[model samples]
Target: MFSGLPQDYSSITVTNDGWWPDTDVADFQSQRSIPASIKTETVASALLMAIGEANAELAAYQSAQRAKGFSSAKDVTGPSAGGVNQLCAQYLKIIFARAKAELMGEITSAEREKANPGQQSEDTRDRLLAEASFAIRNIMGHPRVTVDLI
Candidate 1:
Protein backbone atom coordinates (compact mmCIF):
# COMPACT_ATOMS: atom_id res chain seq x y z
CA MET A 1 0.00 0.00 0.00
CA PHE A 2 3.02 2.23 -0.46
CA SER A 3 3.93 4.26 -3.53
CA GLY A 4 7.58 4.31 -2.53
CA LEU A 5 9.08 2.72 0.56
CA PRO A 6 7.37 0.61 3.17
CA GLN A 7 6.14 2.16 6.39
CA ASP A 8 9.36 3.86 7.44
CA TYR A 9 10.99 0.85 9.07
CA SER A 10 10.58 2.35 12.50
CA SER A 11 6.83 2.27 12.05
CA ILE A 12 6.68 -1.47 11.58
CA THR A 13 4.72 -2.85 14.49
CA VAL A 14 5.42 -6.18 16.19
CA THR A 15 2.29 -6.39 18.30
CA ASN A 16 -0.30 -9.02 17.42
CA ASP A 17 -2.82 -6.28 18.14
CA GLY A 18 -1.24 -4.44 15.27
CA TRP A 19 -1.70 -5.20 11.57
CA TRP A 20 0.27 -8.43 11.70
CA PRO A 21 -0.97 -11.12 14.04
CA ASP A 22 1.76 -13.66 13.40
CA THR A 23 3.98 -11.95 15.95
CA ASP A 24 3.39 -10.02 19.14
CA VAL A 25 5.53 -7.08 20.23
CA ALA A 26 4.75 -8.17 23.76
CA ASP A 27 6.72 -11.35 23.10
CA PHE A 28 9.82 -9.30 22.48
CA GLN A 29 9.00 -6.53 24.95
CA SER A 30 8.58 -9.18 27.59
CA GLN A 31 12.24 -9.96 27.14
CA ARG A 32 13.77 -6.48 27.05
CA SER A 33 12.97 -3.20 28.71
CA ILE A 34 12.94 -1.04 25.58
CA PRO A 35 14.49 2.35 26.02
CA ALA A 36 13.09 5.75 25.15
CA SER A 37 15.86 6.96 22.88
CA ILE A 38 17.44 4.58 20.37
CA LYS A 39 19.98 6.12 18.00
CA THR A 40 19.09 6.65 14.35
CA GLU A 41 22.37 5.13 13.14
CA THR A 42 21.78 2.03 15.21
CA VAL A 43 18.20 1.75 13.97
CA ALA A 44 19.27 2.10 10.34
CA SER A 45 22.00 -0.50 10.69
CA ALA A 46 19.64 -2.95 12.32
CA LEU A 47 16.93 -2.35 9.71
CA LEU A 48 19.34 -2.83 6.83
CA MET A 49 20.75 -6.01 8.33
CA ALA A 50 17.30 -7.41 8.95
CA ILE A 51 16.21 -6.61 5.38
CA GLY A 52 19.31 -8.27 3.93
CA GLU A 53 18.85 -11.39 6.00
CA ALA A 54 15.19 -11.71 5.08
CA ASN A 55 15.85 -11.08 1.38
CA ALA A 56 18.59 -13.72 1.44
CA GLU A 57 16.44 -16.28 3.19
CA LEU A 58 13.52 -15.61 0.89
CA ALA A 59 15.51 -14.69 -2.21
CA ALA A 60 13.51 -16.62 -4.74
CA TYR A 61 10.25 -15.26 -3.45
CA GLN A 62 11.66 -11.75 -3.30
CA SER A 63 13.04 -12.07 -6.81
CA ALA A 64 9.74 -13.24 -8.15
CA GLN A 65 7.88 -10.39 -6.49
CA ARG A 66 10.40 -7.88 -7.84
CA ALA A 67 10.12 -9.39 -11.29
CA LYS A 68 6.40 -8.68 -11.06
CA GLY A 69 7.27 -4.99 -10.52
CA PHE A 70 6.59 -4.93 -6.84
CA SER A 71 9.76 -3.28 -5.53
CA SER A 72 9.65 -4.32 -1.88
CA ALA A 73 7.49 -5.47 0.97
CA LYS A 74 5.96 -2.02 1.21
CA ASP A 75 4.30 -2.51 -2.16
CA VAL A 76 2.24 -5.27 -0.72
CA THR A 77 -1.33 -4.78 0.39
CA GLY A 78 -2.74 -7.32 2.81
CA PRO A 79 -3.76 -10.87 3.11
CA SER A 80 -2.66 -10.17 6.68
CA ALA A 81 -1.24 -13.68 6.49
CA GLY A 82 1.47 -14.01 3.86
CA GLY A 83 5.16 -13.67 2.99
CA VAL A 84 5.33 -9.89 3.01
CA ASN A 85 3.65 -9.74 6.37
CA GLN A 86 5.98 -12.34 7.80
CA LEU A 87 9.06 -10.60 6.40
CA CYS A 88 8.01 -7.24 7.79
CA ALA A 89 7.20 -8.82 11.13
CA GLN A 90 10.60 -10.42 11.41
CA TYR A 91 12.33 -7.26 10.24
CA LEU A 92 10.61 -5.26 12.96
CA LYS A 93 11.78 -7.67 15.64
CA ILE A 94 15.39 -7.41 14.53
CA ILE A 95 15.30 -3.62 14.38
CA PHE A 96 13.79 -3.43 17.84
CA ALA A 97 16.39 -5.80 19.30
CA ARG A 98 19.38 -4.02 17.77
CA ALA A 99 18.18 -0.53 18.62
CA LYS A 100 17.23 -1.47 22.16
CA ALA A 101 20.76 -2.81 22.75
CA GLU A 102 22.05 0.75 22.91
CA LEU A 103 19.47 1.68 25.53
CA MET A 104 20.35 -1.16 27.84
CA GLY A 105 23.86 0.12 28.26
CA GLU A 106 26.56 0.00 30.94
CA ILE A 107 29.02 2.62 32.09
CA THR A 108 32.40 2.13 33.83
CA SER A 109 32.89 2.84 37.52
CA ALA A 110 34.43 6.21 36.78
CA GLU A 111 31.70 6.98 34.28
CA ARG A 112 28.72 6.55 36.59
CA GLU A 113 30.56 7.98 39.61
CA LYS A 114 31.45 11.08 37.63
CA ALA A 115 27.77 11.94 37.30
CA ASN A 116 26.75 10.89 40.81
CA PRO A 117 28.51 11.54 44.11
CA GLY A 118 28.72 7.91 45.31
CA GLN A 119 27.57 5.92 42.31
CA GLN A 120 29.66 2.99 41.06
CA SER A 121 29.60 1.13 37.76
CA GLU A 122 26.45 0.90 35.72
CA ASP A 123 26.22 -2.86 35.29
CA THR A 124 24.01 -3.69 32.33
CA ARG A 125 24.68 -7.40 32.69
CA ASP A 126 21.25 -7.88 34.22
CA ARG A 127 19.61 -6.09 31.30
CA LEU A 128 17.52 -8.36 29.13
CA LEU A 129 17.62 -8.29 25.34
CA ALA A 130 15.08 -9.39 22.79
CA GLU A 131 16.77 -11.78 20.40
CA ALA A 132 15.34 -11.62 16.88
CA SER A 133 13.61 -14.88 16.21
CA PHE A 134 12.78 -16.29 12.73
CA ALA A 135 9.54 -17.98 13.52
CA ILE A 136 7.99 -16.18 10.53
CA ARG A 137 10.21 -18.01 8.04
CA ASN A 138 8.81 -21.31 9.16
CA ILE A 139 5.32 -19.87 9.32
CA MET A 140 5.62 -18.54 5.78
CA GLY A 141 6.84 -21.90 4.48
CA HIS A 142 9.54 -22.73 1.91
CA PRO A 143 10.34 -20.75 -1.19
CA ARG A 144 9.48 -22.56 -4.40
CA VAL A 145 11.00 -22.33 -7.89
CA THR A 146 9.91 -23.82 -11.17
CA VAL A 147 12.63 -26.09 -12.52
CA ASP A 148 12.55 -26.27 -16.29
CA LEU A 149 15.50 -27.64 -18.23
CA ILE A 150 15.79 -26.87 -21.88
Candidate 2:
Protein backbone atom coordinates (compact mmCIF):
# COMPACT_ATOMS: atom_id res chain seq x y z
CA MET A 1 0.00 0.00 0.00
CA PHE A 2 2.94 2.35 0.74
CA SER A 3 4.90 1.41 -2.34
CA GLY A 4 4.14 4.79 -3.96
CA LEU A 5 6.04 6.54 -1.16
CA PRO A 6 9.78 6.55 -0.50
CA GLN A 7 11.52 3.21 -0.01
CA ASP A 8 13.90 4.65 2.66
CA TYR A 9 10.94 4.99 5.04
CA SER A 10 10.95 1.23 5.50
CA SER A 11 14.50 1.41 6.92
CA ILE A 12 13.75 4.16 9.39
CA THR A 13 14.71 3.51 13.00
CA VAL A 14 14.73 5.36 16.32
CA THR A 15 16.77 5.01 19.49
CA ASN A 16 16.32 6.44 22.97
CA ASP A 17 19.80 7.46 24.06
CA GLY A 18 18.57 9.76 26.79
CA TRP A 19 20.95 12.42 28.12
CA TRP A 20 24.72 12.52 27.74
CA PRO A 21 26.85 10.28 29.95
CA ASP A 22 27.78 11.40 33.46
CA THR A 23 31.51 11.56 32.69
CA ASP A 24 30.88 13.94 29.77
CA VAL A 25 28.68 16.11 31.97
CA ALA A 26 31.26 16.15 34.73
CA ASP A 27 34.06 17.08 32.33
CA PHE A 28 31.99 19.89 30.88
CA GLN A 29 31.17 21.16 34.38
CA SER A 30 34.81 21.11 35.36
CA GLN A 31 35.75 23.09 32.26
CA ARG A 32 32.90 25.49 32.95
CA SER A 33 34.23 26.14 36.45
CA ILE A 34 37.59 27.26 35.02
CA PRO A 35 35.98 30.14 33.08
CA ALA A 36 33.05 30.62 35.45
CA SER A 37 33.52 34.38 35.59
CA ILE A 38 32.80 34.59 31.85
CA LYS A 39 29.39 33.12 31.24
CA THR A 40 28.96 31.19 28.01
CA GLU A 41 26.01 33.31 26.92
CA THR A 42 27.87 36.53 27.54
CA VAL A 43 30.97 35.26 25.77
CA ALA A 44 28.90 34.08 22.83
CA SER A 45 27.15 37.43 22.55
CA ALA A 46 30.43 39.29 22.78
CA LEU A 47 31.95 37.00 20.15
CA LEU A 48 29.06 37.63 17.80
CA MET A 49 29.40 41.37 18.22
CA ALA A 50 33.16 41.15 17.74
CA ILE A 51 32.71 39.10 14.60
CA GLY A 52 30.30 41.65 13.13
CA GLU A 53 32.66 44.51 13.93
CA ALA A 54 35.64 42.60 12.56
CA ASN A 55 33.79 41.85 9.33
CA ALA A 56 33.01 45.50 8.82
CA GLU A 57 36.57 46.50 9.64
CA LEU A 58 38.02 43.86 7.32
CA ALA A 59 35.79 45.00 4.51
CA ALA A 60 36.95 48.56 4.97
CA TYR A 61 40.60 47.56 5.26
CA GLN A 62 40.44 45.37 2.18
CA SER A 63 38.75 48.14 0.25
CA ALA A 64 41.56 50.47 1.21
CA GLN A 65 44.18 47.90 0.37
CA ARG A 66 42.62 47.42 -3.04
CA ALA A 67 42.34 51.13 -3.62
CA LYS A 68 45.99 51.58 -2.70
CA GLY A 69 46.99 48.66 -4.96
CA PHE A 70 48.62 46.83 -2.08
CA SER A 71 49.83 43.53 -3.44
CA SER A 72 51.12 40.71 -1.30
CA ALA A 73 52.48 37.26 -2.02
CA LYS A 74 48.93 35.94 -1.83
CA ASP A 75 47.56 38.46 -4.33
CA VAL A 76 49.81 37.12 -7.03
CA THR A 77 48.86 33.58 -6.15
CA GLY A 78 45.25 32.54 -5.52
CA PRO A 79 45.75 30.76 -2.16
CA SER A 80 47.71 33.51 -0.34
CA ALA A 81 44.79 34.43 1.90
CA GLY A 82 46.52 32.55 4.70
CA GLY A 83 49.63 34.70 4.25
CA VAL A 84 47.52 37.86 4.39
CA ASN A 85 45.77 36.57 7.49
CA GLN A 86 49.09 35.83 9.17
CA LEU A 87 50.36 39.33 8.34
CA CYS A 88 47.27 40.91 9.84
CA ALA A 89 47.59 38.73 12.93
CA GLN A 90 51.22 39.76 13.37
CA TYR A 91 50.34 43.42 12.96
CA LEU A 92 47.53 43.17 15.50
CA LYS A 93 49.82 41.43 17.97
CA ILE A 94 52.38 44.21 17.77
CA ILE A 95 49.82 47.01 18.03
CA PHE A 96 47.90 45.46 20.92
CA ALA A 97 51.06 44.62 22.84
CA ARG A 98 52.40 48.16 22.50
CA ALA A 99 49.11 49.77 23.50
CA LYS A 100 48.64 47.43 26.47
CA ALA A 101 52.14 48.07 27.70
CA GLU A 102 51.81 51.84 27.41
CA LEU A 103 48.40 51.95 29.10
CA MET A 104 49.42 49.59 31.90
CA GLY A 105 52.58 51.52 32.52
CA GLU A 106 50.63 54.77 32.84
CA ILE A 107 47.99 53.28 35.12
CA THR A 108 50.50 51.47 37.29
CA SER A 109 52.61 54.59 37.71
CA ALA A 110 49.56 56.63 38.71
CA GLU A 111 48.33 53.95 41.13
CA ARG A 112 51.76 53.54 42.66
CA GLU A 113 52.06 57.27 43.29
CA LYS A 114 48.61 57.39 44.88
CA ALA A 115 49.18 54.35 47.05
CA ASN A 116 52.72 55.13 48.16
CA PRO A 117 52.10 58.82 48.90
CA GLY A 118 55.59 60.26 48.14
CA GLN A 119 57.47 56.96 48.14
CA GLN A 120 58.01 54.87 45.01
CA SER A 121 57.14 51.17 45.12
CA GLU A 122 59.44 48.84 43.20
CA ASP A 123 56.85 46.08 43.43
CA THR A 124 54.45 48.09 41.30
CA ARG A 125 56.82 48.00 38.36
CA ASP A 126 57.25 44.24 38.65
CA ARG A 127 53.52 43.66 39.05
CA LEU A 128 52.63 45.89 36.13
CA LEU A 129 55.22 44.20 33.91
CA ALA A 130 53.90 40.78 34.88
CA GLU A 131 50.32 41.84 34.22
CA ALA A 132 51.25 43.31 30.86
CA SER A 133 53.10 40.15 29.92
CA PHE A 134 50.08 38.05 30.80
CA ALA A 135 47.78 40.32 28.81
CA ILE A 136 50.11 40.18 25.80
CA ARG A 137 50.16 36.40 26.01
CA ASN A 138 46.38 36.28 26.04
CA ILE A 139 46.11 38.64 23.11
CA MET A 140 48.69 36.68 21.12
CA GLY A 141 46.85 33.44 21.79
CA HIS A 142 43.54 34.84 20.65
CA PRO A 143 42.53 34.71 16.95
CA ARG A 144 42.77 38.30 15.77
CA VAL A 145 42.03 37.98 12.09
CA THR A 146 39.04 36.69 10.21
CA VAL A 147 40.12 35.83 6.67
CA ASP A 148 37.84 35.68 3.70
CA LEU A 149 38.66 34.42 0.22
CA ILE A 150 38.01 36.89 -2.50
Candidate 3:
Protein backbone atom coordinates (compact mmCIF):
# COMPACT_ATOMS: atom_id res chain seq x y z
CA MET A 1 0.00 0.00 0.00
CA PHE A 2 0.92 3.63 -0.23
CA SER A 3 1.11 4.29 3.45
CA GLY A 4 3.79 6.94 3.59
CA LEU A 5 3.19 8.68 0.34
CA PRO A 6 1.98 12.28 0.37
CA GLN A 7 -1.70 12.86 -0.11
CA ASP A 8 -0.93 14.97 -3.16
CA TYR A 9 0.48 11.89 -4.87
CA SER A 10 -3.07 10.81 -5.65
CA SER A 11 -3.66 13.97 -7.65
CA ILE A 12 -0.48 13.67 -9.74
CA THR A 13 -1.66 11.00 -12.16
CA VAL A 14 -5.11 11.58 -13.66
CA THR A 15 -5.12 10.16 -17.16
CA ASN A 16 -6.47 6.71 -17.81
CA ASP A 17 -4.84 4.51 -20.47
CA GLY A 18 -8.07 3.78 -22.30
CA TRP A 19 -8.88 7.47 -22.63
CA TRP A 20 -6.08 7.96 -25.15
CA PRO A 21 -3.60 6.03 -27.28
CA ASP A 22 -0.11 6.50 -28.66
CA THR A 23 -0.42 6.32 -32.42
CA ASP A 24 0.97 8.09 -35.41
CA VAL A 25 -1.06 10.63 -37.32
CA ALA A 26 -1.68 8.34 -40.27
CA ASP A 27 -2.84 5.46 -38.12
CA PHE A 28 -5.11 7.72 -36.11
CA GLN A 29 -6.56 9.20 -39.26
CA SER A 30 -7.17 5.83 -40.85
CA GLN A 31 -8.53 3.97 -37.85
CA ARG A 32 -11.43 6.27 -36.98
CA SER A 33 -13.12 9.26 -38.50
CA ILE A 34 -14.77 12.09 -36.65
CA PRO A 35 -18.43 12.74 -37.09
CA ALA A 36 -18.98 15.76 -39.26
CA SER A 37 -21.90 17.01 -37.22
CA ILE A 38 -20.27 17.08 -33.80
CA LYS A 39 -18.25 20.07 -32.61
CA THR A 40 -15.56 19.99 -29.95
CA GLU A 41 -17.25 22.64 -27.87
CA THR A 42 -20.49 20.69 -27.96
CA VAL A 43 -18.70 17.55 -26.87
CA ALA A 44 -16.99 19.36 -24.01
CA SER A 45 -20.27 20.91 -22.91
CA ALA A 46 -22.03 17.56 -22.98
CA LEU A 47 -19.34 16.04 -20.79
CA LEU A 48 -19.66 18.90 -18.35
CA MET A 49 -23.41 18.42 -18.19
CA ALA A 50 -23.16 14.69 -17.55
CA ILE A 51 -20.59 15.00 -14.80
CA GLY A 52 -22.58 17.80 -13.22
CA GLU A 53 -25.73 15.70 -13.11
CA ALA A 54 -23.93 12.70 -11.60
CA ASN A 55 -22.25 14.85 -8.98
CA ALA A 56 -25.53 16.49 -8.10
CA GLU A 57 -27.20 13.12 -7.64
CA LEU A 58 -24.40 11.97 -5.38
CA ALA A 59 -24.64 15.10 -3.26
CA ALA A 60 -28.39 14.68 -2.95
CA TYR A 61 -27.99 11.10 -1.79
CA GLN A 62 -25.42 12.10 0.78
CA SER A 63 -27.60 14.94 2.03
CA ALA A 64 -30.59 12.63 2.38
CA GLN A 65 -28.52 10.18 4.41
CA ARG A 66 -27.40 12.95 6.69
CA ALA A 67 -30.95 14.30 7.14
CA LYS A 68 -32.24 10.89 8.20
CA GLY A 69 -30.46 11.09 11.56
CA PHE A 70 -28.60 7.93 10.58
CA SER A 71 -25.41 9.88 10.03
CA SER A 72 -25.51 11.57 13.41
CA ALA A 73 -26.72 8.77 15.72
CA LYS A 74 -24.55 6.05 14.30
CA ASP A 75 -20.88 6.03 13.45
CA VAL A 76 -20.62 7.52 9.98
CA THR A 77 -17.26 5.80 9.66
CA GLY A 78 -18.85 2.39 9.88
CA PRO A 79 -18.83 -0.15 7.07
CA SER A 80 -22.16 0.96 5.57
CA ALA A 81 -21.26 4.62 5.10
CA GLY A 82 -17.91 3.63 3.70
CA GLY A 83 -19.60 1.23 1.32
CA VAL A 84 -22.07 3.83 0.15
CA ASN A 85 -19.36 6.43 -0.38
CA GLN A 86 -17.29 3.89 -2.27
CA LEU A 87 -20.21 3.04 -4.52
CA CYS A 88 -20.88 6.71 -5.24
CA ALA A 89 -17.21 7.31 -5.85
CA GLN A 90 -17.14 4.44 -8.30
CA TYR A 91 -20.13 5.91 -10.09
CA LEU A 92 -18.37 9.26 -10.34
CA LYS A 93 -15.26 7.53 -11.61
CA ILE A 94 -17.23 5.88 -14.40
CA ILE A 95 -18.77 9.21 -15.32
CA PHE A 96 -15.29 10.73 -15.54
CA ALA A 97 -14.02 7.82 -17.63
CA ARG A 98 -16.87 8.18 -20.09
CA ALA A 99 -16.22 11.91 -20.32
CA LYS A 100 -12.56 11.24 -21.02
CA ALA A 101 -13.45 8.75 -23.73
CA GLU A 102 -15.82 11.20 -25.37
CA LEU A 103 -13.19 13.93 -25.30
CA MET A 104 -10.70 11.51 -26.83
CA GLY A 105 -13.14 10.76 -29.60
CA GLU A 106 -13.40 14.47 -30.35
CA ILE A 107 -9.63 14.90 -30.32
CA THR A 108 -9.11 11.93 -32.56
CA SER A 109 -11.75 13.13 -34.95
CA ALA A 110 -10.27 16.59 -35.08
CA GLU A 111 -6.75 15.29 -35.49
CA ARG A 112 -7.85 13.04 -38.33
CA GLU A 113 -9.25 15.98 -40.26
CA LYS A 114 -12.70 14.51 -40.07
CA ALA A 115 -14.43 17.49 -38.49
CA ASN A 116 -12.17 20.30 -37.38
CA PRO A 117 -8.97 19.15 -38.94
CA GLY A 118 -6.02 21.57 -39.12
CA GLN A 119 -7.86 23.78 -36.67
CA GLN A 120 -6.54 24.40 -33.18
CA SER A 121 -9.31 22.86 -31.13
CA GLU A 122 -9.57 22.28 -27.41
CA ASP A 123 -7.30 19.48 -26.33
CA THR A 124 -8.26 16.57 -24.10
CA ARG A 125 -6.53 17.97 -21.05
CA ASP A 126 -8.43 21.24 -21.17
CA ARG A 127 -11.77 19.56 -21.76
CA LEU A 128 -11.31 17.11 -18.89
CA LEU A 129 -10.27 19.83 -16.49
CA ALA A 130 -13.26 21.94 -17.43
CA GLU A 131 -15.65 19.07 -16.84
CA ALA A 132 -13.97 18.30 -13.53
CA SER A 133 -14.39 21.89 -12.41
CA PHE A 134 -18.06 21.79 -13.31
CA ALA A 135 -18.51 18.58 -11.36
CA ILE A 136 -16.79 20.00 -8.30
CA ARG A 137 -18.99 23.07 -8.36
CA ASN A 138 -22.12 20.95 -8.72
CA ILE A 139 -21.17 18.88 -5.68
CA MET A 140 -20.28 21.87 -3.55
CA GLY A 141 -23.42 23.78 -4.44
CA HIS A 142 -25.85 21.22 -3.08
CA PRO A 143 -27.74 22.09 0.11
CA ARG A 144 -26.30 20.58 3.26
CA VAL A 145 -28.44 18.06 5.16
CA THR A 146 -29.39 18.33 8.78
CA VAL A 147 -30.51 15.44 11.00
CA ASP A 148 -32.93 15.74 13.91
CA LEU A 149 -32.87 12.86 16.40
CA ILE A 150 -35.82 12.61 18.76
State each model's C-alpha RMSD to the native: 13.1, 20.9, 15.7
User: Please, what are the lDDT tens digits per residue for candidate 3 over residues 49-120?
Assistant: 555555454565456656765442132333335435433343444355445545565556545643543333
Error of 1 at 144 (Å): 17
In angstroms, what RMSD does candidate 1 have relative to the true structure?
A: 13.1
Q: What is the Å distance of residue 24 in model 2 from its true position?
A: 20
The local lDDT score (0 to 100) that residue 2 gets in candidate 2 is: 24
What is candidate 1's lDDT per residue for 1-150, written digit by digit as tens? 124642222333322212222333333333343321343344444434444554455566556756877666555554445445645655555545443443334312224434643222223322212243333343346333336799
Question: Which residue pairs in candidate 2 have backbone atoms (N, alpha carbon, C) closer than 3 angstroms, thus clashing?
Answer: none
What TM-score does candidate 2 reach?
Answer: 0.25
Q: For each candidate, give its TM-score against the true structure.
A: 0.37, 0.25, 0.29
Assess the local accuracy of residue 77 in candidate 2 as a C-alpha lDDT between 0 and 100. 21
Question: For model 1, which pairs clash?
Answer: 14-25
Sum up the clashes in candidate 1.
1
Total clashing pairs for each candidate: 1, 0, 0
Candidate 3 local lDDT, residue 42: 50
In model 3, where do residues sit more than 4 Å from their true spots? Answer: 1-47, 68-85, 110-150
